[model samples]
Target: MFMNWRRIRKWHFLRLISMCCVVSLLMVCWEHVDHHVVSHMKSYSYRYMINSFSFVNKSLSVSQEEAARFNSFPYLLNQNNVCKDKDVLLLLFVKSSPENFERRQAIRSTWGNESYVSHELGVILKVVFVMGVHTDVTNSFLLQDLHEEHKNYGDLVQQEFLDTFHNLTIKLLLQFRWMHENCAHARFMMSADDDVFVHMPNLVRYLQDLRRRNVRDHWVGHVHRGAPPIRSKNSKYFMPFDMYQWNSYPDYTAGAGYVISGDVAAKIYQATLSLNASMYIDDVFMGICAIAAGVSPQEHVYFSGEGRTPYHPCIYEKMITSHGHENDIRYLWKAATAPEVQGISSGLVGKLYCTAVKMMLLCKPYFSNTYSCMAAFT
Candidate 1:
C-alpha cells in the first residue's frame, strides 16, 4: 500500500510539470499574436486616415491652369548650362529667397560648396539654389543681381511665381519640375532650406552606403508622424477646416532637409500631376504627394528638423543636417568636418565613448514640447 501511494504521488507531480510547460508555450504564442494584431491595426488606422482626406481623385480645385503650367514653366535661372558634363550623384536643391544673397554666399563657401565636396569626398555633388520672382516688381535691382549671379554660378533655378511665405508650395513644385526635366538621372536628390547646414561628409557617406546596399524607394530625414494641423487663425501654420479636414498630416520628412532616391523623386513628380498643389506648407504637401505615390518617409534621428541641434562632438559625428544656421554655417561646417572627427575610430571603444557622451548631453529634457524633448534623446 505504501509503494502504491508513492507511485501515485510521482504521477501527479509529472502531470503538474506538463501542464506548466503547456501554459508557458500558450502565453508566448498569445503575446506574439497580440503584437501582430496591434501592428496591423495601426497600419489600418493610418491608411483609413489618409483615405478620409483624399476627397478628390485626380481633380484639383486649385487653379487647373496653374497646374498645367508646371510642365512648361520657363526657367528664369537654370543649371543645365553648367552641370551637363558631370555625372552627378546627389543634386541638392536649396530653397532660398531672392534677397538671401549673403546667406547663399555663406552656404556656397561651406557645406554647399560642390567643388570642395567633390575634391575631398570624390563624390559628384551639385548644388542649385531654387527661388521665385520677387513679389515687389519695382525691385528690378534684385532681379538684375540674380541674373548676374546665375550667369556667373549657373546654380539658380527660378520660376515666375511671386516669392512669399504663402507661395512656398509654388517654389517646391518648381523644384520637382526642374529635377524631372534636368537632373532625373542623378542617384539621389535633397531639398534643403538656405539657412540649414548640411554635414556633407556624413551625408555623402550615408548615401554611398545606401547605394552599396542597392536601396530603392528611400526617403529619409526628420520624420513628423501624426502631426496635427494648426487651427488657430493667427498661427503662421493655420489650416482652416475647408483646406484640410484631417486630424493628422501624413508622415513627412522635415523640409529643412530631406533626401529621396532618384526614382522616388520621379514618382513624387508624377504624384504632383494627379494631386492638388494647393497646400501652402511645402513639407506637408510633399508628404501628401509621397503618400499618394506609395512612398514612405523614414526617420533618421540625426536630421534636425526646424530646431537647431545642440552642438556636441557626439552629435556632430553622426549629424546630417541642422536648421537655423544662417550666420554660423561656416563655423559649424568647420567644426563638424574637422580632421579629429573624421579620424575617430569605429571600434567598440570609440563607439562606447561617443555613446557615453551622447547620454550625458542628451539624456536631459531640453525642448519645451515633451515630444520634441524625447525626440532629441532618440
Candidate 2:
C-alpha cells in the first residue's frame, strides 16, 4: 500500500511538471504574437492620438490679453529677397521649425536647390523656410542659433507667435500674408513641409505644362474629399461641435505639399482675413479659405499626403512631391533625376515601361485600397 501511494505521488509530480512546460511554451508563443500585434496597433493609433491631442489643445480658449497679442503681432522676420526677381516662375514656401536646420539644408542641397533649378531647368525657383518663434523659453540658445542661421541663409520667414502644433493655422496665415505682400507676382506658389522631397524637374515640367495649357484657378495636390472631422476625444484631428458645426469638410488638398496658381494664392490670402481662423489645422483651414474663395482642389497622384511614396525609378520619374523624406531626400533626388530617367521622354516605349512598373509597384493588391498610382499623365 505504501509503494502504491509513493508511485501515485511520483505520477502527480510528473503531471505538474508537464503542465508547467505546456504553460511556458504557450506563453512564449503568445509573447511573439503580442509583439507584432502591439507594433501594428501603435502605428495605427499614433496618428489618431496625435490629431486628437492637437484638436483638444486648440479647443482651449486664450485669455483676452493673449488674444490681443496674437492678433496684433507681426508675421515677418527677415522677408529678404523672396520676390526680388519679378521673373520668378515658382515660389516654394517650406514650413519648418526654427531648429530644423539640417532639414532645411538637406532641402537646399536636393530638390529645393534654387540655383540648380534655375541654371539647369531655366525655371526660377525661389525656396524659403517659413517659421515662427520657438515655444520653449529654455531653448533661447536654439532661437539665437536660428537667428544667425537666418542671417546666413536669408531664407527664413518668421513670425512672433509661439511655434506650436496647435498654431499651424497661424503659420499658414503668415505664409499667405507673406505671399500676398512679398511674392504675389510669382506665377505659381507651392507650400510644402520641410520633410517633403520635391522633384524640381518634374514639378517644373508639370507647371510648365500647366502654363502651356493655361490652367488657371488651379490648386492641385492629393485631394481629400468627403472627409469628416474626427469626433473622438483621443484623436489628433478631433473637432468638437462648438469648433466646427459642419459634418463634412470641403474638398481640400493635403498640406504636406501642394501647388496653387498665383491668383489662387492671393484669393486664399484674402479669404483668410474674412473667414474665421479659429481652426488650427493648416491644411483644413486652407481648404476652408479655398472654398470661401471659390477654388476647387484638384487631385494629383504624384503629390503624396502624410504618407511616403514607394521609391522606384518609374515612380520617381512621375513623382512631384513625396512626404516624410528627411534623411532620404538626397538619395531620392539622385535616383529621380538620374540620367536614364531624364533621357526617357514621354514616348511609346517609355510610357509602356512606366505603366507596367506603376501597375506592378503602385497598383499591387496590397496598395489597392490605399494611396497609389492612379492615372498616368501621358
User: Which one is best on TM-score?
Assistant: 1
Q: Give the TM-score of candidate 2.
A: 0.78
lDDT of 1 by residue, 166-239 (tens): 88888888888888878888899999999998999999999999998989999999887766676678889988
lDDT of 2 by residue, 131-202 (tens): 888878578798788778878878888888888888888888877777777888999999999999888898
Worst window of 10 by summed lDDT in candidate 2: 49-58
* Alpha-carbon lDDT of model 2: 0.77
* Overall lDDT per candidate, in order of appearance: 0.79, 0.77
lDDT for 50 in candidate 1 is 66
